[model samples]
Target: MKSLVSSEIVEPYAQALMSVAKTHNLADRFGDEVRALVSALEGSADLSQFLANPFIKVADKKAVLQRIVGDESHPFLRNFLMLLVDKGRILFIEGIGKQYLALLRELNQTVLAEVVSAVELNDAQKESVKQRVQNITGARSVDLQTTIDPDLIGGVIIKVGSQIIDASLRGQLRRIGVRLAA
Candidate 1:
C-alpha cells in the first residue's frame, strides 16, 4: 500500500538521495543502509521520537545517529543523514526509505506484489501466481509478499504496485451483488 505521506513530499528527497548514491556507485549499499536505519527507527519509538522531536537540536540527533551507526559507516550515508537533519526532514525518513526501496526495485526491474489468499499458498501456487502477475504487468520479476485472509473464503487477491486483481470469493460476491442491483 502507498504511504499516507504525499509522493510530492517523499519523492524529491528520495530522488536527491538516489542521485548521491548513484554518483557514489552505492545505490544498492545505501538502499540497504537506509532500510536498516528505518528498521531501527521502527523498532524503537524513543529513538524515532528523539530524531523527530522539533525541540531537539539537529546536531545532537546527528551525533546520536553517528554514534549508533559508528565510524565504519559509509560517509555518503552519514552525510545524507546530516543533510536530512539540516533540512529538518529527519522525521520523514520512513517515507524516504520506502521511496528509496521502490526506486531501487524499479531500477532492478522488480515489482512488489502483495498477494492475499484464503489459505497460505504453496510453493507451486506461489510460482504460478508470480508468473501470472509477471505476464499481466510485463515486469521482469515479481517480488511477491503473501498474506492469508480466511475471510476471502477462497481464491486470491493480487496487488502489484497500484493495480489490484481481485479474484477472491468475497470479491466475486460483491460484484454479483452490484450486478443484481443494477
Candidate 2:
C-alpha cells in the first residue's frame, strides 16, 4: 500500500481531476480545495489514520469525508474523494494534491524553483534568485523553496522543473577534481 502511494502512481488521478477542473473553469478553486484537504490531513492525525485504515469500510469513509468537507465542497473534489475511497487510495491524497498543484502551475506557465545555498538568504537575495529562475525557465512566476547547506561552501544551486543550475563551490570543486583525474 505504501509503495503504491508514490507520486508516479498518484499523478494520473491528479491529471484526471485537473482536466475536470480546467473544463469547468474551476482550476484555481479546486487547487485551493486540494491544498486545504492536504493541510487538514496533515493537521489531524486521527483524520489521517481514519482515511488510511483499510479496516474501515469504503462507504463509511466516504460518509466521513463528505461530512468533513461539508455540503458546499466542490462537486469535482467531492466525487474525486469518493473515487479514491472506492479505489482504496485515500493514503495517496497528499501526493495527489501535490501533483495536482504541479500540473496547475505548469498549466499557468509557472515553475517551482528550489534554491540551495551555503548560507541563509536574505529576502532580497531570495527574490533575486527567484527572478533569475523565472527568467531562465521562461516561467511567468517562480515559487521558490530555499534551503541552507554549509557543504555547498559558497554560491547557490537552483533547480527548476527538470533542469538544474549548479553554481555551488562544492559542485565546481568536484568538476575540477574530475577533470584533473581524467
For all candidates in order, the CA lDDT equals 0.87, 0.88
Worst 10 residues of 1 by lDDT: 1-10
Model 2 residue 179 CA deviation in Å:
5.4
lDDT of 1 by residue, 93-174 (tens): 8788888988988987889889999998999999999899899989888877788999999999999878999999999999
Query: Candidate 1: which pairs clash?
Result: none
Per-prediction tally of clashes: 0, 0
Clashes of 1: 0
Residue 39, candidate 2: Cα error in Å is: 5.6
Candidate 2 runs further than 4 Å off: 1-9, 36-50, 57-75, 118-120, 148-150, 176-182
How well is each residue in 1-182 modelled by candidate 2, as lDDT tens digits? 65564856798999999999989999989877887788788789999899989999998999999987888889879999999999888878878888898899888888998899999999999899988887787878887778899999999999887899999999999999999999
Against the true structure, candidate 1 reaches a TM-score of 0.74
Which ten residues in a row are the worst by lDDT in model 2? 1-10
Which candidate leads the pack in TM-score?
1
